[model samples]
Target: MTLNHFDDQFEDSPQAHDAERAEDLFVLLSCYLDGEVTPEERKQAERLLACDSEARQIYQQLSCISSGVQLMPVAENPVSAEETTAKVFARMRQQRQRRLAWGGTAIAAMFVAAVSGLSPHLGPNNQQFAHTPAPVSEDIGNLAPSETEPRSEQPLNREDITSRALFIE
Candidate 1:
């Protein structure tokens, strides 16, 4: 229906401010035509159709359209309900399988990293770098006080340790 015609039709009704009621009447009419309206809505629709010529015309038009749609032929290749359900379930199954595959790949990658010593910790309190041997030079080894000598109270020189570390010797 044209907007102009609909506006004119709405304007002709004395209860123009009651747009909500008009919408309810249209819903009632639709439900009635489909034989699905409650008794109260059916009574209201019938009363409106009897009193208002415009409402009666709209109801007639809707009824005619509903009948026309119902009379149309079915599609040439209609899929049955069971086939549609099967396709939907199959799609869901494929999605679940793909998700499982991705999860398994992530788990395998973490396991490989841990086994190859690339991970930060192999086990609790077991760091990868903790067991690595520090490089030592023969010069520093010789300068260390002999364990066989008498013990002394003096501390070792800090300068020598700093220079040895900085120069990698």
Candidate 2:
């Protein structure tokens, strides 16, 4: 009935009845009570329950405690329905603010992309400048003098002279 009675039952071997072991069992029981225990641990606990009467009784007592703890009524808020609605509205407003912030960021990114895409066509000043055709120059005479009509026949090997001329230039 009492935790002390449960404590006394396992006092012969205090090491066997470690608080940590009980706490581990309590956690397992909590998971079991919530229907969240793994299949393996659940099977092990069930096997232990089948073989040991004391273990079963202790489990039953703990189960009673668990159920009692779970069934205890939670405290209700003192706030009126209007106040609750106000809190809900405030939360909605905060959520909307967050969404708006993300939306603004997306819009800014899109605007930047649009501007960058248009940059080459828009020129340096972001203004559309027309492509003007370059003016063509009138024909000019040959800048170099004619070789055959020249006076100095200094036995110029033309190929070697041209190659040397290219390097000299």
**Which numbered prediction scores highest in lDDT against the true structure?**
1
Query: Relative to the true structure, how large is the alpha-carbon lDDT of every model?
Result: 0.80, 0.73
**Clashing residue pairs in candidate 1 (N, C-alpha, C atoms within 3 angstroms):** none
Q: Highest TM-score, which number?
A: 1
Give a tens-digit lDDT track for model 2, residues 1-169.
Answer: 8999877776757786676567666666666667888999898777767896655766888889877998999879678899999999999999999999999999999998888777775445556435433433454554456676767867878775554442311
Worst 10 residues of 2 by lDDT: 160-169
Candidates' TM-scores?
A: 0.43, 0.32
- In terms of lDDT, model 1 sits at 0.80
lDDT of 1 by residue, 6-92 (tens): 999887887885676667667788888989988888888889899988678779989899989999998999999999999999999
Candidate 1 wrongly placed segments (more than 4 Å): 1-28, 35-51, 71-73, 118-169
Candidate 2 lDDT score relative to the true structure? 0.73
